[model samples]
Target: MELENVIDAAVEEVLGLAQGWLGWDGRPVVFDGNAWTPHKSLRRVTDHLVDHLAEIMCRLNGLDPLPDHWHGRTVTTHADFARFTETDLEEATSRLTRLALMYRAGLRGLDPAVLDARPDPDTWTLREVVEHVAGVVYYARAMS
Candidate 1:
């Protein structure tokens, strides 16, 4: 389907899995040889969403996309190993839901041709970028 529906579904799916992580034992699960704790997973998911959302906005506004300096997922921080709390879940839900809604509002109507067109020769089409962002659902599921 469209970017809005795809991203909304992925966000809800991630949140649903996150709801069950209150009992995590401060252990990380490995995926593709990368360690993922609850905090790390949540961080990756949100950061990925925000990064691409900002990229899309910048492109739409005809401005260059500013760099989002991320940790690049290679090093896990001390914060990533902290115990996950109920408040963490609530905050994640709020942030992700709001982001998904913003996607909906921002992309509600657009020319089909424009969505399929690359913002530049070096970049993916906007639709492809949105699909990649939706893949953040992998983070929550990795803990399961």
Candidate 2:
């Protein structure tokens, strides 16, 4: 899928999860007996998309991923999910779009061979995951 499509899907999916299956607090889908935390839940959702973007960059370079830690986990506390308003959502979306645009630009400007070159093993590269959740939304104004 195209980058815009991927981003849109991520946003829609997150909103749906937040409004429906997952509460504002990021509770686990399983309510019967699960430890749900709101902050962590939000982080989980955010990290999912970030990881996808990272994977895309990694695949372009033909590198194996480091073992991931949160492959499977259960919700446990309010700190996991936290709380945010609709405005926060809008801002975040905007920031992501902006960052995505920049990424696109950088991708376009790269040499064909260098685009896929791997960075030094111990050095961080552009594809390294960033924890700035609202980056694109904040600077790019892509959020709606």
Candidate 3:
């Protein structure tokens, strides 16, 4: 799929999820025998999406992906993953919306050649990852 289509799909899906899950009080939205509390602030999830989009943006500009190891770490415990404050939610939504708009603009201005070019041999090209995120966003919704 085109990068723009992928990005648009992801944004729509995430916004829809956010609308539905806005009332969530950080309970375990999923627990299929495995002990994991998947529920989190919409802020957390929005922040994550923005971070990954930034990674894509950097990769598109021929830069290395920065290690945001903090995001990769697990929550301290079930209790620690509680609901976010109204302020936190507001900030996250603002940042995420800005990031999403930037992604859309970037997609509009990107050259086809740039999208086709591979950034690394072992990794996916920038375009591939953009589409991959669209797929992953769906998975994120299901698992959330």
Candidate 4:
């Protein structure tokens, strides 16, 4: 499947599962040794998306990717334990849907040759980067 489709599906699935998180039992779910509350999961997925998008932008601009300060994958913040509400769900949906669209449009604008090329042996190709972030479905699934 195309990388864009992979991201779209993941984002959709995450948002779908997130709908039921309003009734969260006020406990974190353990996944890969990380504690995942609804806020933490949403934060992780958004961070992952923005991080990769920054990488793509930096590479295209002949610059290095910005360093990420995200520690959500391991550190559970106090805010992470907050209640999940209908308002939060709506915000998440709007935020993630726009991010997914940006991801898709960004990838689609790149030349096919550039998408597959590995300019830096140290990093994954652009397509691979997109595919990697598509795995964000795991974050949302932890809420189930």
Best candidate (score: TM-score):
1
- Candidate 1 per-residue lDDT, tens place, 2-119, comes to 6668889999999999988997899899986789888998988989888988988888888899877888567689999999999999999999999999888767896778779975
What is candidate 4's CA lDDT for residue 112?
80
lDDT for position 42 in model 4? 95
Once fitted onto the true fold, the runs of candidate 3 whose alpha carbons sit more than 4 angstroms away are: 31-44, 68-80, 84-92
Cα lDDT tens digits for candidate 4, 35-141? 88999999989989888888987887889888777765889999999999999999999999898998888777578899889986888998888888899998988
What number of clashing residue pairs does each candidate have, in the order they appear? 0, 26, 0, 0
lDDT of 3 by residue, 84-130 (tens): 45554465457656766777787787888887787568777667767
Which TM-score value belongs to model 2? 0.45
Candidate maximizing lDDT: 4
lDDT, candidate 1, equals 0.86
| Model 4, position 129: C-alpha lDDT score | 88
Candidate 2 per-residue lDDT, tens place, 1-144, comes to 433343454454455443432224433334324444433444554555456456546655677665566643354544544555576556555654554554454355455455334567764443333223223222111111
Q: What TM-score does model 4 achieve against the real structure?
A: 0.93
140 Cα displacement, candidate 4 (Å): 1.1
After superposition, the stretches of candidate 4 with alpha carbons farther than 4 Å from their true spots are: none
Listed in order, each prediction's TM-score against the native is 0.93, 0.45, 0.68, 0.93
Candidate 1: lDDT of 76?
A: 83
